[model samples]
Target: MTVAEIKVIAKEMGVKTSNMKKVDLIRAIQRAEGNPICFDTHSRENCGQEICMWRRDCN
Candidate 1:
């Protein structure tokens, strides 16, 4: 994945994207995408136009 995408995911996850390791970010994203609860709580359940699950909140 690209750095920009990682950053975006990190941001959605309420993480400091600029300071996170790529490996860690990737893992968080995978977990968020894998679970509906995390995705809904942080990523997709938002009312705003931009809704992204706390990509790290799953695992």
Candidate 2:
């Protein structure tokens, strides 16, 4: 998703988006949702979260 779209989700979740990069913001959002902070981690290649919404955007 675009940064603008991510920002909207972050705002709704009450996460501070200022000064945070896209990866960081996504990780923060994952944390807020009680999920793992593994948006673009090294383990993405073997990621087990097949149903994760952010999977498509992950590098």
Candidate 3:
């Protein structure tokens, strides 16, 4: 998602988005949701989270 879109989600979740990069923001969001902070970690090849919402955007 775009930074703007991610910022919206972050705001709703009470995550401070200032000065945060997209990957960091996403990882923070994942942490907030009690999920793995695995975005762009080069784990996609072994990441079996097919139903994850961030799958498409993951590297």
Please give the distance, in angstroms, between residue 2's alpha carbon in candidate 3 and its true position after superposition: 0.3
> Among all windows of ten consecutive residues in candidate 3, which has the lowest summed lDDT?
45-54
Q: Per-residue CA lDDT of candidate 2, range 26-51, in tens?
A: 99999999998889887778878999
Off by over 4 Å in 3: none
Candidate 1 has an lDDT of 0.53
Could you tell me the TM-score of candidate 3? 0.92
lDDT of 3 by residue, 2-57 (tens): 98999899999999999999999999999999998899999988888889878889
- Give lDDT tens digits, candidate 1, residues 1-59: 56678788667877665566665666566565563323333344343424433443322
Clashing pairs in 2: none
Q: Rate the local accuracy (lDDT) of all candidates.
A: 0.53, 0.91, 0.91
Write down the lDDT that model 3 would get: 0.91
Better of 1 and 3 by TM-score: 3
**lDDT for residue 15 in candidate 1, whole number 0-100:** 61
- TM-score for model 1? 0.38
